[model samples]
Target: MLEKNHILTPEKWVKLHADYLYNYTISRINNHEISKDLVQETFFAALNAMKNFEGKASERTWLIAILKRKIIDYYRKINSIKGKAEVRMNFYDDGEHAGEWIEERVPSSWVSEVEKDIENRELGNALEKCISALPEKYEIVFRMKTIEELETEEICKELDISSSNLWVIIHRARLQLRKCMEDNWFKK
Candidate 1:
């Protein structure tokens, strides 16, 4: 008993939805390889669970849903307890607040973990928009040092910049990130 409005068409998945899925993955993951892997994984998972499809959603929408879960799982795997470095260290050493992301400095005493997951999604989108709005260099360095949690020396050497220059760039990037988060996320 399936709905006539929607049907599972697994054979056409690649041609019909590959590009759309890849584009979505790349924008969120920021790593081409990981995004590709997630897209492929989504296809596999959907195939295995195809029997469970109720035809409630179009193939594309259902695929995107699976892809979103895959993306979330990827991030969770990278940010696990063993990946403590993934957490951005606080740059400031003040009397009050010692360390955390520049995004956290915006005073979000309102957002509790007990809140709805939808709120978190909106916040993530806003943060992502702010991050993408950053200047190219800023965005790259910020992701490398903050999001990717690469070592200071590693990032500096890879980017072919002096340690001091890297720090300057990171500081400026954090400042801009804070401002952007405040304006875009907090205001919402």
Candidate 2:
């Protein structure tokens, strides 16, 4: 049961949405090449799933939903690969003790001092710098869970990661941020 008014042709969709979708994606991803690929992929996926289109939402909304999922999938894939590499790099030679913070990498406590200086504008700037310095995967997860206030289950579902993995990533991200803030803001 298709609605004649809502049925969209591919050419019409491309003409109407191609630039908008590209701009939307590029704004979020900050990459022209990847945004182009994702937009193209979105069109192909929408084309294939046209039969299931319920026509409840606008065509642009439906396509954007698919594109959003594609972007999340891309991030998930990157985090999975980086997670494996992180394990290898951070572990000892025995391989039995992975995911443990090394003695040298252990961060000192700065929470008390940070609390005292919470109103300092420099502290906020330093925090932003630290967050931006994190690897893309960790930064995304940290921002989503901490800054965006997204739930653990929501983050896990969006990133396609396990609960344990999410915890590990968050822990590492926090540690890195703490170390960064201590070095850049607390000491200075």
Scored by TM-score, the top model is 2
RMSD of 2: 4.7
| Candidate 2, poorest ten consecutive residues by summed lDDT | 84-93
What are the runs in model 2 whose C-alpha is more than 4 Å off?
1-44, 47-52, 80-101, 109-113
Which candidate leads the pack in lDDT?
2
Q: Could you give candidate 1's per-residue lDDT for residues 95-117 as a string of tens digits?
A: 55456444555445434543454
Q: What TM-score does candidate 2 reach?
A: 0.66
Candidate 2 structure quality by residue, lDDT tens digits, 103-140: 66665665455567989887788888988787777877
Shift of residue 141 alpha carbon in model 2, Å: 1.1
